[model samples]
Target: MSFKQPLKAGAVIATLDVGSSKIACFIAQMTDDEGGFEIVGVGHQASQGVKSGIIIDINLAESAIAHSVHAAEKMASRVIKGYPLRDVVLAVPATSSESHFVDAHVQMMRQNVTENDVRRALAKAQVKAQKEDREIVHTIPVDYVLDGHRGIQNPYGMSGQLMDIDIHMLDADFAHLKHISQCTEQNHLDIVSLCSSPYAAGLSTLVDDEIELGSIVIDMGAGVTSYAVFQSGRLLFAGGVPVGGQHITSDIAHGLTTSLADAERLKTLYGSALATISDEHEYIDVPMVGEQNARGEQHVTRALLINIIQARLEEIFEMVRQGLEDSGVEASICRRVVLTGGASLMPSIPELAQKILGKQVRCAQTLKVKGLPDATSGPAFAVSMGLISYYTQRPYEMPMEIASYGESKSFAERFKGWFKENW
Candidate 1:
């Protein structure tokens, strides 16, 4: 029942990522040695009833989740009918997520600072961050100032008269969280923890140097493009833009007079974020929309398709640049940008990102996760794999309290049910 404990050797962990394009499930076992973890099973299905990373149709979303979980279970040789899967770590996109800074000054009672003093300061900051309707998803202590000396990583057992602490907290829409929880519950899964998608993707892709030197990780998914800022091995900011690969697909469909499926195929095969002179000679057969009488096929230059994709992608990068500026993080810290996710696979996307974002840009694939299939080990799977990495590296102490669904059931009743099932 304790979520704070790390996954021990031989312990099993499951992660579920519900994105606008797909629902991914992963099952892994902690290795006995430093090999870390092994992917026992993996499953993914085309996302349905979800739009812009939000669940719209509960039944359809639940069915998609169930199918994904079942597929992973079959691969792992675990059957849900006999031994039910109970808990899962969920990855959620930060749609409309906001960041806030909370500062607290605590007068130390004793001569030396202890764990209690640090805890008290964090608790006071959390109190100040409390809002009526918002749910705080992450409460990270960015820096600790002990007796006017700042940037102390850990203040415990230090001698100080006063302790000043600054915390970065991320808050999400409560209604969105409730809907996600309900959908997972419908599939008989209890959410053990939640991690932001962009943050997770960064963890899975960025190298240690990239994190320490400060960088931005942009996850361009099907329906939403999310980014996270990291510096000194901690997440500084997270935000998302509604436009993503799906929007590009729709634009291609409209611009070329083709169906959605055909547009997607073309986007995958011939899409490029930057156009060259040679593109004019490269032609693609585009299907005409609503043409039923032998006028279905049309020839279009690849340059046109690249133009359409470039327009939308430029806008996306511009939005990201503006978001970073609004956050007030210096451009120097975010000098490097790492692009990931499905949409980032388009040719020359890195070049386009560099031109628009004005940063050194590179497309990243997911870091190797033990036993992960080569086909499934790509940038698109970064978030799901990062969930596993997060669990393995998380501290023993739990930080923020997850917001409840505001149910009418009593605490005793809920605890009893959870205990009975898990114990």
Candidate 2:
């Protein structure tokens, strides 16, 4: 099927991020200025039926999605009895996403490069990137080589006999994506586009300097921590580790013998990745598990809580380090590390990340998007805000119907035919 038409100026666009810990929705209107959009409404609810960034119960997921959407609609002052939200940009997890590099070349017809030539090269690369059970989510042209000269960003007006392009393609499990689509459809929402979690996070947190100089964005979410590498203003690699903030909470609950709710409260109030000298003297009240009243409350030193939190966070960063190495992009991630998400709010996380990841680390919230409320401007909302930014940027390819060229035709001949037919 052909892709949906791009949003017009002043058109309302909604984005939904079905994260492992929370389901968030944002409604915004596109502006006339390029890369300019404003948030009009926002809604979020505690995530249920989702674990490690994947949906486990469709019914519960659907309800949570519906609730968040309705809340956003109400805030926007736009409500409908039937299908109020028709289209929404969705964010998918990077748990099973894979990246593949493909190269394609086209022979010039009149010694001048054209958009058609780029499209043909991209189509060829796309064809080669196909897998048996996976679907392509992103196809980004990283660099262009023309006549042996490399690093060409705009080769449209350049002259070259052979145009070679290196494309980075991201693919994910088809069944997992299909299930996500099903859950959205249950709420009468049409999937406008599916963006990877890491890609969205990078878009939201990375600045122009970081993108140009190369950097890594770590989205430390509740149930999963995902990272993506950006170089030359494009995403180069994306990966995720299943461990996240929720795991630490679980560990605290288990170690302290408390309820999950109380453990979460304690983690948010006093959690730290590194213990200080004063932690031993600081005392906190802990409600023992299966306790009926205040009699079951226990006092534990802050040192004990920090120990549990620190152990889990250290393991998470270690896994992140290994995942980056396994991705083979460790060398490219040289500029700095930017951490976002609810878990990143921990006081000592940036310090721990710098010590373990061996780079300068900074905890970042979402960049300033106009009309975004202060309440929703933290790291926890990075993915959702990034979805809006992605919609405004519209970095993906536009779906087009191409005319078929005969098998006997050469590359130049097919390029001419496709170019004439389309443009």
Candidate 3:
């Protein structure tokens, strides 16, 4: 899909972040100040009928979407008159998608390059992206090559005999996208665009220097953990693991024989990924799954909880480490890592990530946007806020039909044919 349209000035923008554990909606408006985004409404509900980035029950998903959007719309209506929320930018989960790099070169007719020449190069890469069973989510430009220069940022006006482009393409399962689309459409909201969770987290959490100088964003949601690499202010890599905080909660629940709700509460209030000897001295309450009396509750050392949490977190970070190794980016550029998303809120997650990923890790919040509450200033709202911020930037790609059908395409490639049909 083409991200050619940008957020309009003084226009109201809505965002929906659908996840395994929670669904959140934000109704915001663009202000006169450049890059200003003021929130008019907000709503969130415990997500149902979605697991690991796939829709399991359309009715439940639609109901959840409706609840979140309507709550935000009601709040927004109180703030602005005559403007009803009708469209939203959705955050696509990276767990249900695949990210790959495509390189294509165009021989420049003239030594001086033009924008058309750059388009031609990207178009060649797009042709390789077509497949019937999958749909393109984001086609991001990673780096440009001028002749043999490997890291040229842009070759728009430069002189080069050959222009090579490295583009990052994210394709999601076509059926999965259709189900999500149906849920949102059922809620009377139009999905204007879809931004991957990793890109959204990076956009909302990373600073200017981190984006340009190179940084990795690890977004730990309830049901999925996604990581993105950014360099020169562009997305270089993105991938995800199905295991997330929810899995940790399940571990706590199963090991302690407690309810899922109680398990979540414990994880939220007292979970830690870095256990210490001192934790054994501290005690917390654990309620049994089916308890009627005080006898159902038991005392457990914090160390026990920490142990369970740490084990799952270690596994998560190990997977992230492996993903980064396979993501095609070099170790030198993976020096800085930023932790975001709701699951990243767990204590010592960054510490554990640093230890496991062997990179400098820090927790970050929503940056470069305005009018967010203190609660949303953390990493949890990174995706929703980034969905709102997506309008401030310009991204170019082909139309929504960036696919070639009626053939045996393996769930996934075709940008070259689009160029011929369009230009």
RMSD of 2: 5.7
Compared with the true structure, all predictions reach lDDT values of 0.79, 0.79, 0.78
Q: Rank the candidates by lDDT, best first.
A: 1, 2, 3
Residue 386 accuracy (lDDT) in model 2: 83
Model 3 agreement with the true structure over 1-423: per-residue lDDT tens digits: 233345555788888888898899998887754556688888888899999877899899989988988888888888788676767787879887888878878888787987666665565566566677776777677788887898777666788898888888887787777787777766766666678888888887888899888899989988899988888877777889999989999999998999999999999998898988899899999999999678999999999999999999999999988988887687456689999888888888888888888889999854544566676566888888877666556346322322222122332223223212222
Which of candidates 1 and 3 is the stronger one according to lDDT?
A: 1
Q: For model 1, how does the per-residue alpha-carbon lDDT over 252-329 read when each residue is reduced to its tens digit?
A: 999998999989999999999999999999999998987765578999999999999999999999998898888865
- The C-alpha RMSD in Å for every predicted model, in order, reads 4.3, 5.7, 4.9
The regions of model 1 sitting more than 4 angstroms off are: 1-5, 33-35, 78-83, 292-294, 396-423
| Candidate 2: worst-modelled 10 consecutive residues by lDDT | 398-407
Error of model 3, residue 263, in angstroms? 1.5
Per-residue alpha-carbon lDDT of candidate 2 for residues 181-238, written as tens digits (9 for 90 to 100)? 7777777677666678878888888888998788899999988999988887778888
Residue range with the least summed lDDT across 10 consecutive positions in model 1: 402-411
